[model samples]
Target: MEISPDAIIILKWNGIHINATIVFTWAVMVILVFISWMATKNLTIGPKISRWQNFLEVIVGYMRQQVREITQQNPDPFIPFLGTLFLFISVSNLLDIIPGYQPPTGSLSTTSALAICVFFAIPIFGIAKKGIRDYFKHYLEPSIFMMPFNIIGDFSRTLALAVRLFGNVMSGTLIVAVLLLITPLFVPIVMQILGLLIGQIQAYIFTVLATVYIASATRIENKPNKIEQKEGSKENE
Candidate 1:
């Protein structure tokens, strides 16, 4: 059985091969774009909103709230990047129910690409919030000797993100495929449903982790003033 959508070639011309991963990834993107257009083309603040619009608003609101809670700051700036990550992954995984449809996220390359985006986004958001100098200064916190370790930590976490997503997605697909071969018909069906749940969960986890990393990068440490410390000490006394 094919372990990755990247191995399934759908087209070939002039020594170039197009795989299922590319096709399905584009398919998911088109579906999202089309649905988004249809839902918002007639957007209104009035009470007569469509169901799709209402559903999308709820999702967006939840995401914004989560970001707010995590960063303790305005969520507007981070929503576009983080929202797209959540939506893309969630939709990709949710569509696994369709027969013969391979989720692009099942591919290591895709997950790695997503992880790399988060990796770079960390510094970008950090630098934007704290300025280039202030952001990089944290890597040397307490001592200049820790700079290499801090840098390594960043790369390690990025690698973890990629492997975590890729392994979960690929394993789920593999389990369903193997069950279909040896198990009864109903068994595979049940596993498919479970796979769907796992997929949604993985998407949520990936998004939450990305949000946390970005939040950490952008967070401002507000140390209490000496006056406040004295006031608290006096209160205790």
Candidate 2:
């Protein structure tokens, strides 16, 4: 079996090639953009709402609520990113049902890209809310000796996120594909259904873990430092 979508070279030069992961990621982006445009084209605030609008509102409301509960801050800043994360993952997983479709989530490269995005986002959000100096200070918390451990934790967590997602998604796809080759119709169908359920669960787990990471970083920024607050008041006086 071709283990990675990246291994499927679409073009090759001296050292350059386009891969299936990039192609399918763009495909997913286009699909999302199209769906969003169609769904919001006729949005209204009246008593009667379009069915698509209603469906979108429900999903948005749920996602917003989840961000609020996790971060306990205004969900507006997070809704776009978190909603897109959930939507892309859930849709990619579900679209495995499409004939001849390769879910990009099954690729380590793709999952690593996602994890890296989260890795960068954590500090970006932290810096935005906490200020650059304070955000970096987190790495030295408890003691300066802990800085190495903090750095290691950051890398390890991102690595874990990428591997966990890729493993679950790729294994599910492989099992279903392999079963299709050897199993009877009923058996393969059962495996397909189970694969679908696993896909959905993975999407949820990834999304929730991402939310938690962002929430933790942003929450730290939101909390006031007692010593700093007292020092600030004395300076003002």
Candidate 3:
């Protein structure tokens, strides 16, 4: 199939064209808002919980465990930010399962937007916790000469996150669609299930990497105290 590059709808306002990707992103945001409202409507710690509530709780618990395991520390402080990220990305990716619904994260625009959020968030949170000077000083870690390379590499990781997510989700959607078109038999069903599995795993992987990056940004590294070392050497002498 010869798919046109102009596969997206364009809306013009004041000579500015807003593409389908933006529209899709807005749609996902709306869905996210609704889901959030619904999930928080009736909160309780009772024996009788709705299935929806239970499911959401299970997801939250899993994310908490994963974050703790990855960071080897209490993830309570990071829960709200990382948990929302995991939920949003996972749900966005799974939207493909709905007929006629395309996943927002399948496009580079959406993935890049999320990656950019993480990019900005890492620095903002890092500086907030460690002070602006100290946070920037992190780039010169182990030596000041490595500053340029470290800065470049850090930004490059954000780009990698965006591209990796976009490529993986888009490939899964395209491949499954192609198979379904070619043979409408039992093959498509199998492919769909496999796609679902891949989608969930990819979402987990993306979120985990994001958590790791944020953790690194906020982590405190042990530095040797020159004064203490000198004092110890004088005592030894």
Best by TM-score: 1
lDDT of each: 0.87, 0.82, 0.74
Q: What's the count of clashing pairs in each model shown?
A: 0, 0, 0
Candidate 1 off by > 4 Å: 222-237
Off by over 4 Å in 3: 1-6, 16-18, 222-237
Q: Residue 135 deviation, candidate 1, in Å?
A: 0.7
List where candidate 2 sits over 4 angstroms from the true fold. Answer: 12-15, 221-237
- Tens-place lDDT per residue, model 1, 109-165, is 899999999999989999999999989988897699999998997887788888888
Q: Where does candidate 1 clash, by residue pair?
A: none
Q: After best superposition, candidate 3 residue 220: deviation in angstroms?
A: 1.5
Superposition TM-score, candidate 2 onto the true structure: 0.89
lDDT per residue for candidate 2 within 52-157, as digits (tens), equals 8898899999988888886788989877877888899988888888876788999998999989998998898878888899888988977999999989978887
Model 3 agreement with the true structure over 1-237: per-residue lDDT tens digits: 412112565688897767666666677778878876797789789999877778878988888898887655578877887777777777777777787667777778778888898898888777876789888987886699999998897788788888878777888778877988899798877877787777787787777777776666666663234423532342231
